[model samples]
Target: MATTINEIIRDSLELIKAEHLNLTPDNYAKVFCKVAKQKGVIVEDCQKVDKYTKKLDPNIVTDMKRFNIGNIDELLAFLVAKLNRANEGDALKMVNTLATLTKRVLQAITLLHDTKATSLANASLERLDFHQNLQSIDLVKEKWFDFISNYDDSYLKKLDAFGHVTKDDLEVMVRDLIKILSKDDSTELYKTLVPLIIASLSPSIASGMNDELASISNELRNSPDALGTPALQQEIKHLISKRIDLDKAEVQKKVAALDKILDEINKKILELIQSSNFSHEQVKVIKKDLQSINFQQDSFETVQVKLLNIASSLESETRSLSEKMISNQETITKLQNRISKLESALLVAKQEVKEDYLTHVATKRALANEMNRVEDAFMRYKIDYTLCFIDIDHFKMVNDTYGHEAGDVILSTVGKILRKYIRQVDFVGRYGGEEFLVILPSTELAQAIHFADKIRAIVEQFKFLYKNERINVTVSCGVSQRSQQKSKDETLSAADGFLYKAKEAGRNQVMPVL
Candidate 1:
């Protein structure tokens, strides 16, 4: 039987699920663009687009459009083909627009399925009027299902050919969805389907199926049956017959590397021993150096035992490290939840407590402590992502015109929203009056800037209703990811400069210098 479109989509989804990696929107966008182009829907060829453009998935129309995914697919393919054909520097410029589209699509997709409305989701739906007549689109839903069932097997094969799906890969897939959905932002189809694609990549998102292939190495090493009596073992000939080829290429490479290291160490030792200043003191230093080398040799020898002792050590190390990373991730998550709760509590307390100087100082102290806790957590990861500071554009006017109470409300509202929008790994603090700082762990400047834009939009659109008068607010933001060490003053000064620039250019924008 020829596969229906729904079956094709379903099988493709299954193939995606079979992999042990997270399927990000970027991956789907790339694959979708490839498939759409192959089907002659997209104008450009997949080979021509840059990785980010491919992730964007520009302009492909489908019989069943979901979240302009088809449009994104077509556009990305066209851009990719165009870029490759032209081989121009403009490819870099394409990234900003692609990234913006990606954010819009992702935010939109998240909202369509969300029963509970989040600010991002609400904004997406609002932009497209996605919620209006949303519950009454049965034909659209049916067509989408049919499209998935009859999706081509060749497309799945193409996806497999793309090979390993990394975080970057996943982003491409999402961008593709965005492109398709962008065509008819009025439709909520892409918004519905994008999440479903993400769902398929769940296994990869979980414990990682990549580890499964090597897990047998550990089981064989630990199995008592492998070491049982010969007579008993003789009954199961297959036990000894099984000679699973474990990839020793990496081990061999390591061995070669170690040998080179040893050679260098030996040369150094010989030089010390033959030194003109050779004496009891020199001899002692040589012995210490030799002991250090021996200690390393001992460690390597211990590791080599498994490789040489009919049991590979790869399993033990991979499992151990994976577990540690997972635990650390969980710890970060818990800490984030705790911090969010604390922020909410503090905000509530601000409303309840008297706005006296002593109270304000005490509250500020508490907020600072929370920020410190977030910094400590980042320290444990030994990552450079926690670098952050805040700038509130010339806010003396708010204090002067709006009265201190209104200024307080504005500050509090901004602080609350910042805390809410940021992920668990991110931190926000009241650095000083009309100034707040936010630290983002594991984020690059580009990512931080994108997030800042999203938050800025939220603040701009927020309805500040106080005593029946409507209040509108705007902010200038400067975001950067710290990759090198600089004095605190210097770093803050640079960020402040960016904020000033943004204000100069026009407030309500995020400027990031990489």
Candidate 2:
């Protein structure tokens, strides 16, 4: 029984180390939970153990008395208590609360630092220092207090507008702030932050417009020309209600119409001015005729004043009309241009959805679709097809040693190499994680293996870099031909089996010994 306990503990720690996971107290607690559960034991309040200090040592978790479980028996009892104390959901909630509070304090510190509020930044950092000395529950409470106290009224109002603050809202705000921070303009930080907060108040004006436009389209399809239909006169009380939501092309057309309206208004106003000159000419003739009839001075002056006032009022009204027309035209043009860009972006996004964003290759869903197509061609036409599964060796170690950003760079580089080297007739896709699939149509195993070995050799010799540091990497591939397999699934299974064989025979080599 002691030997069983020792082996389990050793294997769990080794697995965690192999995965390159941080051997923090929380991770250690989790390991204990796993082993205890395996031994048919339940641990309650396991989160309590997670509160232990995150001291960096892979050995500490497996053998420390600081976690209050020095022996195997004590470990089992502790695990049972931890697991049974509360549900996993409650534990997750606690963890999220801690994370959110910590993030908020960090953001406050950043904001204060940018504003040259050195004193405030120091205080915030001191509070964090103060946090480390306290218990986990107290640490969380301290962070919350620091976060709420640090922000001013304006920031609070923004938070309030988000409506009953939650972790999700904080996460959104944090993500947006981080994006803005990349611009590195500290002067307009608050200015930028405010709009982002308000923008999050709803689904988005453009998205709402899209939905309204779709609804109108549906309504028209059911009864064609909904506005012009006489039967629905009761529904739309006004003869010309208001601006209706429209698509990009329709918006551009409306913008052009608005431009015409502006031009016509300007022309009519100019024509009105020309007519005023004619009116003045008529007034002069009237004055001459009145003088010939010996009219009174006071009467002539009064008539002239009335005509001048009328002309002045007409000119003022026309000027206002011209301004409005120009303003409306400019607004419509800008909106139309914005809509065109948005539609173009949406099209690109839809295309990207079908591709593996990181790899720039077919996504898993797309690969699945291609697999079905290839299988159909094989079954119907008896065409030969081969598939190779490729996996990167020691990918986790690369991530652990260099960082996830470096891992991403390496993955993208590998993807680029695969795409560049493969034939146009063959299809390559990211199967997921560090794995890729190369689907060869009308090709035999011999041909597939040759291609695999070539790719393997290229990757082995390829010089990869992440942050100016050179990194070496290799791939192991399993090649299989679809000859006797009953279906696509069976063929893939055989390919996976060979891929594992490649890994077992020492990575950086292809399967089937050649």
Candidate 3:
């Protein structure tokens, strides 16, 4: 009843095929063991491999299971392969760590802001880059070692002159320098400002404060340095307060004098009514109202109301009195109309200065104001913004070929598009001819670049028509974030530089190509 070895072998081959397993040695041995056991033959267990595998690390045992490593030879090969991969990974990690360290070192050197340090950092960067491209970590390490060993830190001593060269120290130094300069400037400013303040005083007000004004002016001119002391500053503030009080008193005095003049006129009118026999209901009403008027109130509104009521009563009285009153009323109305016209003209002039006539966006003056506002916000709150410098491509050519009118239309259209797309918090302005500045508050550089690209595409696709002729138009944009630069002007200049790059690369594109 026992199976022969050849029959067991034949049965193992058939079972392997039936089980849809590969005919490898491990599969054959396992199947052969199974077949022999079924035929009542004693067979060796293939599970003996597990005893050795269990003695290995759990991770290795898992790998053996995964890779089907049944024998010692297979296990050895897998272990070797795993070891090779781990070695490669560790080498990569070491190289990355070195690169990161080198980068950080270069950044620190750059922050020193010294010419020599910058030169050394640049050279090191070049060498690091060369080694990194070659993937030779040993060479990189050697180069770094040589840089450190041969590096002369003598130049660093110069930074000690700046007192530790920290941010706080630099800020303190700047403050001290500004204080000194401001003190010098203040002497001259006080000399000029005090005289101007004195000259602006009205004659009535000036009479009362003349002695104080003359003394302050003489002190400011002759001993301007005295203003540096706190005592002198307090004295000047006291003088200013006295001048304000004098002005208020002068205003009240003038109001009282006008009230007296009105009272005299009312008495004269009442006398004329009584003496001329103009006895009517109008006369009674006017008499009653004038008598009831309280001139002692000393308030302008009360006087004006009383005057208006008397004028209303006088107008209805008689033709002769009415004619004279109408003449006076016409004169006053003309003066008021003239004043209103002047105010309206002033307002229009101011608006014209702040807004461009053709584009309806902010003028360069307004843009400057907005820039200052944005910068103040940035410096005070660390709230960042971005500047997008935009220029119409081939603008000069458009002007030359299609006339300046067409160019104006293009400029106006571009400005409108820019203004339309921006958020309410953003600003768009005509920086100059064919140039616009868009300020994106709280925007990152990447977001600004995206916004600029969107605008560029919109401008390029727009159908610009002048005199029924289709004209091609496009724009180049340069964008920069405020925090990335040293100052507002530098940020603007950077945006302009990027714009130049965009134009040089090709028109109708955003610089930085993000």
Strongest candidate by TM-score: 3
Which 10 consecutive positions of candidate 1 have the poorest summed lDDT? Answer: 306-315
Cα lDDT tens digits for candidate 2, 78-176: 556665867768878987788568657666766643453445445555656555554754555555456555746465456554344433455675666
Please tell me which predicted candidate would have the highest lDDT against the true structure: 3
Candidate 2: misplaced stretches above 4 Å? 1-331
Query: How well does candidate 3 score on lDDT at residue 229?
Result: 77
Per-residue CA lDDT of candidate 1, range 89-177, in tens?
A: 57566865675675577576564433433444444445344433544444444444554465453543454443432323546765655
lDDT-better candidate, 1 vs 2: 2
What Cα-based lDDT does every candidate model obtain? Answer: 0.50, 0.63, 0.72
Error of 1 at 107 (Å): 46
Reference-based TM-score, model 3: 0.38
Using TM-score as the yardstick, the better of models 1 and 2 is 2
Error of 2 at 280 (Å): 50
Query: Candidate 1 — what's its lDDT?
Result: 0.50
Ranking by lDDT: 3, 2, 1
Q: What is the Å distance of residue 420 in model 1 from its true position? A: 1.1
